[model samples]
Target: MRHHIVHAGWLTAALAVLGGVFALYVHPDFLVTLVDQIWSCF
Candidate 1:
């Protein structure tokens, strides 16, 4: 259980940093356009 909890903590921290970087480097409009392109065939 302790090991699982420690792994979860590290996972959360990694996700937080990934999210911060994405927020800084990615534009919402670009993401929106990408999603639109992916769904256009549907």
Candidate 2:
């Protein structure tokens, strides 16, 4: 039971992170800035 609870907690955190990333991609301004920053690194 304890193990299952820990697993569920990790899964919830992972989903939250993935959802946040998806939200970022959906925003065009963030996408453009991210690309610009990566290009600058090169």
Question: In candidate 2, how many Å is residue 2 off?
Answer: 0.4
Give me the displacement of residue 21 in model 1, in angstroms: 0.1
- Residue 39, model 1: lDDT of 100
Report the Cα lDDT for candidate 2.
Answer: 0.95
Among residues 3 or more apart in sequence or in different chains, the pairs in candidate 1 whose N, CA or C atoms overlap within 3 Å are none
Q: Give lDDT tens digits, candidate 2, residues 1-42.
A: 999999999999999999999999789799899899999999
Per residue, candidate 1 scores C-alpha lDDT tens digits across 1-42 of 999999999999999999976985667787778789999979
User: Candidate 2 has what TM-score?
Assistant: 0.67
Angstrom error of the Cα, residue 16, model 1: value is 0.2
Which stretch of 10 consecutive residues in model 2 shows the poorest summed lDDT? 25-34
Candidate 2 residue pairs in backbone clash: none
**Which candidate wins on TM-score?**
2
For each candidate, what TM-score against the reference?
0.60, 0.67
lDDT of 2 at 42: 94
